[model samples]
Target chain A: MIAIHGFSPSGNCHKLRMLLEPLGQPYDWVEVDSPNGATRTPEFLALNPNGKVPVLQLQDGRTLTESNAILYYLAQGTPFLAEDRWARAQTLSWMNFEQYSHEPYVAVARFIAGWTPLDSPRRAELPRLRERSHQALAVMERHLQSNDWFSAGAYGIADIALFAYTDVAEHGGVALAPYPALRAWLARVRATPGFVPLPEPDALAADRIAQTA
Target chain B: MIAIHGFSPSGNCHKLRMLLEPLGQPYDWVEVDSPNGATRTPEFLALNPNGKVPVLQLQDGRTLTESNAILYYLAQGTPFLAEDRWARAQTLSWMNFEQYSHEPYVAVARFIAGWTPLDSPRRAELPRLRERSHQALAVMERHLQSNDWFSAGAYGIADIALFAYTDVAEHGGVALAPYPALRAWLARVRATPGFVPLPEPDALAADRIAQTA
Candidate 1:
């Protein structure tokens, strides 16, 4: 069995769970409290020198970091990944967009709103973050207008990658009302077989998220 | 020949040139002046709705966005990408790190210094960007200390991805002097067969980079 070192509320970490459950691939979940400086410790640094989470560790102790890469690794030889070269490249393109263009704005905004104190100075960034989040959302909306899935030709890892954060975007005050196509696509994703939603934020994060919104 | 819509001086765009040259693949370069708002034009948006450069257009009119994904596509079935699954995944992991952790700070700092006016308020971000840039460099240095290349078991697209911004980091006032291993790795990458350095910034931007540095 593979072990995943993750934070429950992080959409990046949740991405792995979303894929693993659907594939019925049993794995161990070793929770890491990323918000409270646990990832900064020496022990965690040994696992990943970059100090982020959702690391996939195999039985022999080899580990893989970066959620999207792990998704690609696990999805290979399964229908979760495509054999067509172009389709695979397109799948990767959307995953790259998720990490670079989408996650930095969408997921970071959620992190600030739900993980920080209400009066934290970082709150100053919300307006700009939300604005950027909408730009990313609009790009997804445009794509969704023509295409039903980001992972080329089907709902696969790319859909799982984008769905993790986009579903919880409202927690960051990024509204779904503006993108009808994106919302419709999200509903379609949820209706897929073996689908599982990300867990709701714990009480403290929920309170902060509510206050921030 | 395929067409590449790119900006010459951009590391993201340069990654493609680096790989294509090594593979002896012929290509058409359609220069997009991204800094001067060329990417914002309606004509360019039809090519890539996300409005970014370094888009790869197949002969049939299918287009691919995201620099790393394009690299993966162009490198397929070639020695530039690994054949083994684990090696390919690790190669992708490093490429993901370059985009998510490295490029936003290192490349953006270079953009701000070389492209923005010396008196532009964006200069205020330089210190923070450079600080984050060094943190990213440190991670690369640590990796290079243990291994010779970022791409698993070879000098491949992952190296091409990281090399683009890192080679010009000093333009952004992110000093390379602190990390000898990283500097050595840059030298090693340049020594690879058919390596092509990114074009120098044009005169106006060059002057700004000098002044900012």
Candidate 2:
């Protein structure tokens, strides 16, 4: 069994769970709540010096960090990842887009709104984050207008990577009401085999997000 | 021949040039000055909505965006990319690390220093950027203490991805004097076959960086 160290509420961490559930891979979950200083602990740092989750530990005790990298590792040779060379590269392009273009704005906004205290200074960054978040969403909407999926003509890890944070963008004050095609694409991803939605934010996070909204 | 649209000074754009040079692939280079608003033009945006440089155009006219993705596409089946599944995943992990943890700090600091005026308000971000940039270098230093190369026991695309920004990090106000292992790794990368250093910053950029320094 694979051992995954992750925080349940984190989109980056949840990406592993969502992908593995569909792959039917049995794995153990070791919760490491980063926002509360769990990730800063020496034990977690020993697992990943970068101090991020989820870290994937193979049965042989070797570990891999970075959520999208973990997805790529686990999805290899499976239908979850593309087999064609160009298609695979395209998949990787979208994954990089998720990490660089999309997540930094969308996911960071969510972290600030939900995880931080109500009066946290990070909230000052919301306006810029929201604008960039919408820009990323616009790109996704444009792509979805012509293609039904982001993951190389199929629902795969690319979709999983984007969907993890995008589906909960509302918590970040990013509404999806304007993106009709993106909304439809989200539905298609939800209908994929063995699909499991990310757990709802905890009560504290939900309350903070509500107050911020 | 592949057609590459890139900014001459940007490390992300230069990653492709470094890799393709070593691989001995014939390619055309179209100068896209992203800092001068070239990427925002309709023609360039049509090619890549992300408005970033290092966009690779295939012979069939399909364009691939994101520098690391382009590297993976070009390096596939070459010795630069590993044949073993685990090693390849590890390579992808380091590439992802370069984009996520390293580039955002190191590369962005370089842009703020060189592209913006010396008195630009963005310069205020330098201290924070420097701190995070050092954190990223520390991670690389730790990894280098045990491994000679980043990708599957060989000098490959992962090293290229990191070296692009790290070699020029001093321009971003990040000194390598403290990181002996990382400095040694940089030297090793410089010695690799067919290696070409990143181009020096343009006159305007160099002047601004000098003023900031």
Candidate 3:
């Protein structure tokens, strides 16, 4: 079984759950909650020195950090993965764009708006973050206008990598109304087979309580 | 021929050229100096909506952007590329690390320090950039301390992604003294088979002028 460590609240951490449910892959889900600082623990750091969430521990006992890397490992050679040369390149390109453009603004702003207290000192940066977040959405809206998908003529990890933040962008004060194409894309991804969403904190707590019992 | 649209001084652009020369691959190189506003032109923007450099155009006229993606496509199935699944995943992990952790700091700082004038507004961000650059180097130093190579037992595009900025890091005011292991890793990368250094701007210009005449 693969062990995934992350808070369910994170769009990045939830991406794997979304992918794995559709693929019918069985694995252990370990909740490394940010509120309690589980991921920063020494044990977790040993598994991933970077001390980030969504570290996948393969059955062989090797752990891989970096959310996108884990996604690639899970999707490679599967039908969900792109096959053609340039198409695969396209998948990577969007993933790159996600890290640089989308994740920085949308993801960070969401963290500021949703996860962190609004009155927290970090909220002071929200104005800059919000502006960048809108620009990111604009980029996505433009590319998605012409194509139904990010790459390979179908849905793939590129969509997954970008989708998590793009969908939840509203929590960060990004109004997606101007991006009709991106809005449509979000609906399509939500409709994808085996798509599991991040469980609300209460639902996750119930699951944990059940497991312990 | 594979046509690389790039700026001479851009480390990301140079990554492709460095990889191509080692494998003895022939490619047409087009200069795009975005700092002077060349990349803002519609013709270039059409090739890459993002207007980023290091767009690789194939013989069939398909343009692939993102320097890392281009590297993977051009080096596929070559010894410079990894053969197995795990090695490929590791290669990508480091590449992703480059984008998220290293590039934003090390590469961006290089642009400001080496290219922007002292009074240029971009230069003002250098203090913050330097802090992040050291943080990034610290991350690399720890990784290189245990492993001679980043991914797999041998070197791959992961090295190329990092080596591009890391080798020229001194230009950005990042001293190599704190990272003896990284310096050793740099030596290992340079000593690898088919390694090539960036073309001097004046030397490459002279060659271009000669070819045009």
Candidate 4:
């Protein structure tokens, strides 16, 4: 069995659940409170020097960090990943885009809104983050207008990767109403077999999100 | 032959050159001046809706975007990518770290320094960017202490991905003197077969980089 150290509400961490449940791959989940500085501890740093979450720990204790890479690894030879080299590469392209272009704006906005205090200086970043979040969503909307899935030929890890954060983008004050195609695609992803939705934010986070959003 | 649309001075664009030259892959380089708004044009957006560079266009006209994804696609079945699944996953983990953790700070700092005017307000971000760049470098230095390469067990695309910006981090005012091991690894990568150095910035950019660095 593999163990995943993740924060329950993080879309990056939730991406694993999105894939594993569909594949029926059994794994243990160890929750880490990232917003509270759990990821910055020395023990967590040993597992991933970069000090980020959603680390996949094998039974043998070898670990892999980065959510999309873990998804790629666990999805190998399964329906969740494509065997075609081009499709796999295209899938990776979307995953890379998620991490670089999409996640930073969309996920960080959600984090600032939900996890940070209302009076925190980080709140100043929300406007720019929201603007960039819309830009990323526009790109996704353009793609979803022409294609049903980001995972090349099917609903695979790429869809799961993009879906994780996009589903909760509204939590960040990034409205989904402007992107009808993206909204439709989100509905389609939710209907996939063995789908597991990301957990709701905790009370404090929920309260903060309600206020900030 | 495949066509690679890239700007000459970008580390993200340079990553493809780092891989293709070593693989002896035949690719036509169509230099796209990304900084001066080439990527924003409707014509280039047709090639990559994301409005970024280093897009790999197959002879059939299908295009793939994202620098690391292009490296992964071009290096398939070659020594540039590992054969073992775990090794490939680890390689991807590092590439993800490059785009998510490293590039946003190191590469952006370089861009703001060299491309923007000296009085540009973006210069205010340099101190924070430099700090984050060193933090990333420290993680790499720690890894390099016990490992010779980031591409799992050998020098591969992961190395190329990280090497691109890391080799030129000083251009962003992020000093490399503290990361001796990382500097050594950069030398080892430079000594690899068919290595092509990143091109020099033009006169105006060079002058800006000199002042900022």
> Candidate 4 residues B1-213, lDDT tens each?
999999989999999989888778899999998888999999999999999998999999999999998899888889889889999999999999999999999999999999999999999999999999989999999999999999998999999999999998888888999989999999999999899999988999989999984
lDDT for each residue of candidate 2 in B53-147, tens digit (9 for 90 to 100): 88999999999999998999999889899989899889999999999999999999999999998779999999999999999999999999999
Off by over 4 Å in 4: none
Model 2: lDDT of residue B175? 92
DockQ of each: 0.91, 0.90, 0.57, 0.93
Error of 4 at A8 (Å): 0.2
lDDT of 4 at A117: 89
Candidate 2 displacement at residue B168 in angstroms:
0.6
Itemize residue pairs with steric clashes in candidate 1.
Answer: none
Clash list (residue pairs), candidate 3: A22-A194
Model 4 lDDT per residue over A27-59, tens place: 999999998899999999999999999999999
Model 3 scores a TM of 0.91
User: What CAPRI class is candidate 1?
Assistant: high
Once fitted onto the true fold, the runs of candidate 2 whose alpha carbons sit more than 4 angstroms away are: none
Task: Compose the digit string of candidate 1's lDDT tens values, residues B32-97.
Answer: 999889999999999988899899999999999999999999999998899999999999999999
> What is the C-alpha local distance difference test score of each model?
0.94, 0.92, 0.80, 0.94
Give each model's clash number. 0, 0, 1, 0
Cα lDDT tens digits, model 1, A48-141, are: 9999998999999998999999999999998889999999999999999999889999998999999999999998989988998998999999
| Candidate 4 clash pair list | none
| Candidate 4 Cα deviation (angstroms), residue A16 | 0.3
Docking quality band of candidate 4, CAPRI definitions: high
